[model samples]
Target: MKISDSFKSAIVEAICLLYILLFVYASVSKIIDFENFQVQLGQSPLLSAFAVPVSLGIPILELIIAFILLFPKFRYIGLMSSFGLMVMFTAYIFIMLYFSPFIPCSCGGILEKMSWNMHLVFNILLLMMAVCALLFFDKKSFFLRTKQFTVRLLLCTMISSVLIIILIFTFSEKIIHNENPFLRRYPPHPAEFSNAVRLKFNSYYLSGFADGRIYLGNYTTPAQIISFNSNLKDRKVHKIIFDPANTRFKVISWYVKGNYFYLLDGSIHKIFRGDIKTWKIDTELKDFPFFTRAIPIDSTTLVFRTNKGKKMTNTIGKFTNEQQVKVKYFEGLLQAQNEGVFDTDGVLMYSEELNKIVYLYYYRNGFVVADKNGKVENRGNTIDTIKHVNLKVSVLKNGTEYAISSPSITVNSSSTVYKNILFVRSQVKGRLENDQLWEKSFIIDVYDFRKNIYLYSFPIYHSSPAKKFSSFLATRTHIYALLGSDLVVYEIKNDLKKEMNSK
Candidate 1:
């Protein structure tokens, strides 16, 4: 259809007005809130490296384009520039929504409130208008000039290709490492409370697990050890036959290893050995170092986190030879934390299959992997970015010692290692996460110790009204969690089980 030049000129003039207004508003908004725009750019996955330059250059470019479109002489060049910019913006949004794992809030001005998908549509509409404006400028000249058309096509392709290449490079690195990107996958409820049994009291804590039965020790009644199977059907309470009156001993913790059960008393600095079947104490290991945290490695040996006599921070060590009870301290594990007493406080887990010790900290995104002999193996990271404890201390009692204002817990809330698979109840949430998913249950991030990489994460629902989880343990097939006074058992999802097996 042959359209009149007058009608085409009118359409082109209207398009020019749209471009001028759009650019003016966009540039003014960015200039007014320049620091915020700069920071948002700095957080972008693709623009982070060039944030400072781009932040300064963007508004200036927008203002220049706006002024150029306002003048009739420069309107043609302005339309072309606006078209290219809109195409670039559209591509950026598309890459962010699909390819990139982390999408930072960086769209400025009117685009800020719009969703990424909506912003893409808005850019696309503007791009179409820019193209139409250019086409209407001189209808016969643009179509008749083949050389001009070919040059413009090639220029657009090269610019678009470069933008895509940049997006690919930035997106690939984060997607592969899975770093702190905070991409969360919620599969069909990975875990659920299938069964639960009410205990005698809230004081009952899981002491150990062996032969599919969970053993519990009471702080109120130190002489009793309660045993219950995973099914919550069979229950037994055994009165621990130990001479507490003579030895002045108090049970700190207990665990089963091999054919025997060991009871540790940090107050008396002694460990008592007994048969698991009979629940009778027969042998005593004296001169054992005072340990706050203890985990049984084998029948004759045990691992502990202790601050024995010295003023040094807590050290990971093993005690073997029941007769002499020789303490071999791990020198390598003590130097990692700032203050070992509280900041380095964490869970000491032992994998029976690998015979490796994993110390997961409560105040950082790092953990220590060590061999049975206290040799350092490798240090690993959690998905969280918190590297140090967020603790505040104040001097008390005339500056002799400092008092902690708020005891900081930065990373792993609770963790357990079984068969080379590390299960952690993470306290810190990651990026690109759903707050509702975290609110419903405890987030359990699984890591493969052999690979030292995150495998997956699953949710374990809260069993009580308080929405607090005291302790949890994962076995080969089942997960036992102490939720208030009820012992809850959740079956591990088949896919997560397979993932762990593959690792």
Candidate 2:
């Protein structure tokens, strides 16, 4: 069928409107949840600094591009603007692909309806429309207008775009925010401590923020379990684990569950609530500076020990604890025999599934697993009769017996996190379900004692290909891997969905 000029113009206009709608929705959603966006940015060496400025500006730019394109006189100008914006976006993607290993979900709300690849394609399509609009040029051309009028209009357009860009840079964070978030509270309170620490095989890290509140996230799932209120000093979070032995809750590293949280700053263990906002001073210790392990055996009991974690911020002094809340520690392996040898800073794992704490130490022999009860079970040993592979271990369940999962990989040297970039060293290959070294990207290796075979792996990286250094999160049903601004979700295999077993 032959289409008329009017009909064609209307169709083109509708298409243009849809693109702008997407842009506006995408930009605005991210603006509303800018802090989450910042975390994503921080995960990348290049994006964090760009986050504040971009967060405020992108939405406004979209609004402008949308409004201008709708105007009959400014149709071509709108098209040109869209083209420029798309170019900027495409460039951002390529840059992220190379410099950053993970990506974040910058698009939220309405725009999230489309996939990332589709989002890119849509932007490119808009660029084409902008170009097409240029071809449809008819009204009094800018060149044909009086020189004075032409100059003024041109000047006005440039000024408008410039102002918009500047606003994006200046108020990007504020405009998106309905309220001032930074001035508000952070680091949740610690109330009770679960008598357990956990090992997170994957990147689903549940850590405490400085505000005595819990801070947790993963790339695969949604609904983060975190709450924050009060300053860092007033927090108490630490826990002690047991191997079929019950221990009292004392000043330890950290604890997580519900209605309870204990934190150990360098000097003392602060006890607070996961459900409440206030905190109380738990008993202070003598060798507080040297204290490391703190595990809660019951509601009012705990066992305290000393083990330094990775970052200074990771100190129990810095983290507020809660019941069943997942936590991780660097735990440079030490010995009960030696009072203090060179502390071995090991893998950073989290409390997941069941309050089991699993950590990978680069042992002179191999690695070991620290169960919820502080029992270090050797996963691999440099000494014979141990597992040598540096596998990713996950804390599965809790109770008399615990469930743990590990996905091993071969890596070279130490992992690196440069600027905002994360470079981990791991080598494991497998497909999504089918086993093919050639086809698998990120390995999701599952170890089922029920199956009697100890091999399972899958790639859980999002935004980019699954690699070391990329951050991730796990939910009941899915896993979300964050690669910079990209948030990729992975649903568990049907067979492994609810088939958790004890080791």
Candidate 3:
């Protein structure tokens, strides 16, 4: 038996009414909580770069479709638009479920309460209703054979909608990581706080990790070394047996690698090497080039950064102390934007497993990866957009002493490198991120050094309001951070662990 024309018309009208209610409710809810909707979009892996425009466009477009569905003359067009939109929504959910690095909640109204799988089913049902309504509605005036032409058009619309989403997904990831517009993609629980230990003073810095223990050096007492076990439960204090009989040591730092620890005083051009078991300075080296920073690659080789040439520009070099000291400089490793001294200043990290040294610029967005012998390998950028240093330098009355005249913007504050991953503490804030979260925690951005791409970012929350992370070190299993007078440890979650294990 064939259905009556009146019955088909009634069916189409009922479906259109359902669509009108859904769109109107969703659009209004999005408008009511507009900031939250935009933030959800900013965290989306597929739409982060286009968050601002898409957040505003989606709700307005929904309202327009709802208004069109109210009129009989335009009901066919509205149904077609609704069908296309539902197809797009279904495709988005599928991609978010399978392909996206992290899923973000962006649905409006009561639909926000639905799981992604449930939302997928809901969109599919709405899509089927749209198709049925289109077939039953009056489309005879628009085409010669209404049913056949409508089916073809619907197929084309579905393909076009899916393609658009795919294109957006492809380009948005590239733009979000490389040409970022200050939008941060924060996945859930990339790192978790495990335990913390408080020190007596705030003058401690993370020296290094060696033999499954975390070592910290005190700035006030340079000879003292505080060590903690992997769990941060067992603590031991060891002092370096050194005597500064006649040498004036203005600054001193400790570095532990493998089985030996080195006490370096760049101001006095001295380096003392001691065995970890005895903590005795058995060897002392003098008359070395002045260096502001140093990291040991092995027992005999050390990479150092120092000012070179007549302009006092910063340069990185490696020296080998076998029978004599042999130094090699990679002058092009650091690029200067303004004053080379401050502009080129950054954190230096070395991965013993990968044999790669990374120089992360404090005032810029990128870092340079080089080999152990000072060979430039790959230059990778962080997710931020700051490419140049925001610094102002002035010469004092003496004309010889220079000082930073203005508060400079720091991009990558502190960093550490494990086997294949580089973890950087970012200082700049991104779009749609909560200000309160920034005030309460420090943001850590992770990158894959092997692929030269950003992996993800997470927050290391502060224990108290007055305490902030001063320095941090990353091991294979955990991250050790120095927050004010406290030493904190965080366990790496599986989401970050997978990226770290990737090539």
Candidate 4:
């Protein structure tokens, strides 16, 4: 039997209508993979020059138009939007195919879920549907009243698109610039800072110079003393400075600590004790963590943070059997909740008068404490435990006080040492030229939360032409400094070895 004319018309309309639904589904798929879609749009040769704004806005418009197209009443308005969008896509695909970068189906899971050949065929079929609507559907949809509405919607979308482009240009850089704020002073020259052991009653200072050199100074007469250096043999060091306050706080969280200097590598600790004239490597602790800062709470307990993503603690011991180095850790205590480590990656806050410190790590890990025993216990893990000292009070914030734990409770995965953070603000008066001659006047500030006060900031000017600067601070009274790879006595005296010899 021959098919009726009305039935044939209905069949054609149904097939054409499926394209509208498919278009809507595709638009939603793109929106779901919005990030990847934007990435693709930006890379697409069609809009690469003006890619950013288009990448951000086009998917929304496409989805809106696709939905409107499904209804016969608003079909004209939908066609207007689809026409503009399709023109852009056609241009994009042709350019990509011509130049031939060979895109491997980056349109998201939905588009890729269809086979590659099928995707191409489906796009062509959709284009044909749009054409058929333009030809036949245009007959009914193109009445004067409907045409007027469609034109107005297109005009508004074009105007809005231009405005979004302008806004993106005006403000996007500021957002990106904030992330790289330290591009100027960041990435100090590289120098090896490991294997630092404590030197008894010596004074040492280690600093990285604006010039490709490290400065090591030893003060003896309260300020004046001998100095030395260590030649790093041309390696890139990120940044360098003396321990912020010349104390145990230099090795915060997971840093290397000893009687001499503290060395904090990415995740390695090297504790050393030697004079600057004669170099020596003492104790090297690897893989523990290259902590940002660490301070000794007492003879037994230590607190610190990994230079990485976590804050940890390590408990000290008196050696039960003279075999294993006994230790425990508090994982995830100080969840770097402030400025998120970017603004203050290697910065510290130390207070002297309060005998306390509020150490801040990069990311959001920071701790506030009035004394050395400020720690937070997670689950069954005990953050801090004092031997002779009684548990007085452990406060989380200024308003609330909570108890941490009793003596000798079980702890795991905590760091015994944290990182030693350093913040140096360099101010120059005149125009700064190329980095070769660029000079930096260093002012250092540290926060010791155990003391609860911001300590003094000191200035470091170009002193002697440093041959090599490698020094470690054991304490305020003792220091081990290196000059040109040679060890020296860092004290307010004549010479360290000579004093030992003369005595």
Candidate 5:
């Protein structure tokens, strides 16, 4: 049966009208919610690096193609263009489905409601319609040829489009991780919520982890300590029995490692040692210098941070209490951006497994790794883009004290190291992240410091609206967070463990 020319023309016109409606509606919807569309693009695993230009360019291109479809002479060209656009969209969905770390939400407008699988199916149907429309147009048109030739051409277009998307995916990942443009890639379920237990007070800070138990120290009650099993099932409170007879201790910090615990009071230059089993102070070491921060290296040595010389610049030093106090300062480990004290203030963590001391800057996106002897190993940057510290300081009263004059941005809030993994609680929100999620939880970024690569990030949801994440400790399989009066635990999923083990 031969189809009439008018019927064929009507069929082609109908398809063209459908495409015009689709493109115009999609383009207008994106334009109406331009900011949202851009944010969605920024979250795309394959298009994040090109989000700015792609977000602006895509809608304009769609509108132009829709206009072209309305003209009779350019109808064929419009159908071809629609076919190519649909091919790219389908290929993008395909890559996102198979290759992306996690799938983001669909594009704006009606498509936003569709699941990724449904969106892929819809794109494929539209793509087939484009091919049909081109075939039904005037048979003499160059686009119409032998059926086999047309199939081959369409297949080539699909393959080429897929390859292009794959290339973009590879390049975007490199840019997003290394030279990030403030975008974050969130892999699904890097850390899963396990359980939480509420504490008596909110002053508990993570002291240490040993013998499969999480230890916490209370700031308000300096000598009090709390210990919990890995699953938060078993909880116990212990106190350090020390006699404060003639010693004037201003601040006391407890550090537990292996089978011994150390009582350090840098303010009065005193060190107390005790056995973890007895929890009693048995010995007081002499020849210790006045310092601000200290971590136990062993039974005899300590890693301390103190003000150096008259400048009071923050410096790291190794202290040994064998016969005499031997202090060795690593002056170059910390680089200051503003006032040496405030700008260089950060979290000091020592990884016993790696034998590396990690100093994570509070206001910046960099960290320094050093060996036990204060030899610098690697200076690595976080996924954030803030290189310099944004701080404003004021000289107080007698010019001896310095205080922050304005609110400063904190990049990495708290961190802990377990074996080869470094877990950092990041304060700054990345591009395309949910504001509600940020309000309700703390984002923990995981990095393999041994490999010097970011593994993934996950959220530790707040136990209560009033409680904020203060400090955390990481073990081989669990991350214990101290949020106000609550101690929340998150189980490390196998996906993260595989990455850590692979390295």
Candidate 6:
């Protein structure tokens, strides 16, 4: 249908008036709630680096465009500017939906009530209006000389594309790294807790993993090793039989490797070796060094941590009966604070695949890696920022340790090493809202032991609000955690599993 020039002008005027009203309302609303607008922009995936300037400039530009559209003399230029701005907004929305790590909160005012999908539709409609206004205002600008308008639109799109690419390249690491603003990388229902069973005692802890089964050792019942299949089915308790008349020693520590288990009594300095298949002690070696913490490397060699008598200096060393290899390898590994005996205590883990020993401090945001001989290899930082043990300890006259102040734990609470990945349960919270998230769930920070870099973190929901996951064992497909007296198994998310396998 052929339309009159006067009717086309009227339609163009109405579109211009609508845009003016929209921009004016939006700009005024942003100015009234400027702080909130700026904060929301700071959380944006692409514009976080220039959040301050963008937050201040967007409203000003909107107001200027609205005023320009109100004047008939500059209406064409105003419509051109509106088309360009709407194109940029629409492109941003499209990229956010497709490429962004996560979507942030909405902009303030009326837009805040709309979802991102709805906002994208609204932007597209406004863009169509701008294009219609531009076409009606021009006669030769569209049909005869298609070259002019097409070139301008293409140029605007190219400019916006370049800007988005640069922002993504520059700020993606800021969003993915430990100091990230976005936290919802995985789904809320990513894992399902199953096969929860009550343990015989709260002191029954995960001793080792071997032969596709988990071994639970109790402190009270040291001779009993409870084994469960990977799926928490087929429970079997193996009782190690020893000759009673040979020697009497309390089992202070127990560990299991491929097909053998070791029981060490640090008080009597005796080591007992037994076959895991037969569950019988065959060899008893005496004159072993006293170690507070120990783990087996082979049937003949062991890695242990012992405290030196003077000044409570603790050191890590290896022990072998071949030539009495009781040499301290990690001397002065602990930084002495007020007291060094218990303040620098940490969990030790040995990875057979990497052949590296990892020492994760309970109070700090760092871990040390060394070879089997205790030679220092590399030291890496955890995601947290704490470096020192925040504790107050005093040594009494009788050489007993006393805590004057209860310390606040701010770093690695629990950690386990498997293959090339180190999974640490963090007590510290990263860049996330909801202060109660820490209380409601356990946050796991994953790191690459081979490359020494933090990969990612995920939340594991707790069955109860007050209960925290004390320890967890990671299998190929699931993670079994000892929560209070019950065991909760959670299947690892497929994406996380792929991430671990890829690295």
Candidate 6 CA-lDDT value: 0.73
lDDT (Cα atoms) of all candidates against the true structure: 0.74, 0.40, 0.86, 0.37, 0.83, 0.73
Candidate 1 displacement at residue 251 in angstroms = 4.7
lDDT of 6 by residue, 402-426 (tens): 5446665857788887777788888
- lDDT (Cα, 0-100) at 462 in candidate 5: 86
Clash count for candidate 6 is: 0
Write down the TM-score of every candidate.
0.66, 0.31, 0.94, 0.30, 0.88, 0.77
In model 6, the runs with Cα more than 4 Å from the true position are 1-154, 174-194, 244-253, 264-268, 322-326, 332-338, 398-406
RMSD of candidates 1 onward, in order:
7.2, 21.2, 2.0, 20.5, 3.1, 5.2
Per-residue lDDT tens digits for candidate 2, residues 153-259, read 54555456545444433442332122221111111110111112122434444433332344444334322233222221222333222221232433233444344
Off by over 4 Å in 4: 1-19, 27-67, 83-107, 112-140, 145-156, 165-278, 281-359, 362-503
Worst 10 residues of 2 by lDDT: 185-194
> RMSD of model 6, in Å?
5.2
Clashes of 2: 120
Which regions of candidate 1 fall more than 4 Å away from where they truly are?
1-178, 308-310, 322-324, 394-402, 463-467
Cα deviation at 195, candidate 3, in Å, is 1.5
Task: Flag clash pairs in model 1.
Answer: 182-431
Better of 3 and 4 by lDDT: 3
For model 3, give the 10-residue run with minimal summed lDDT: 137-146
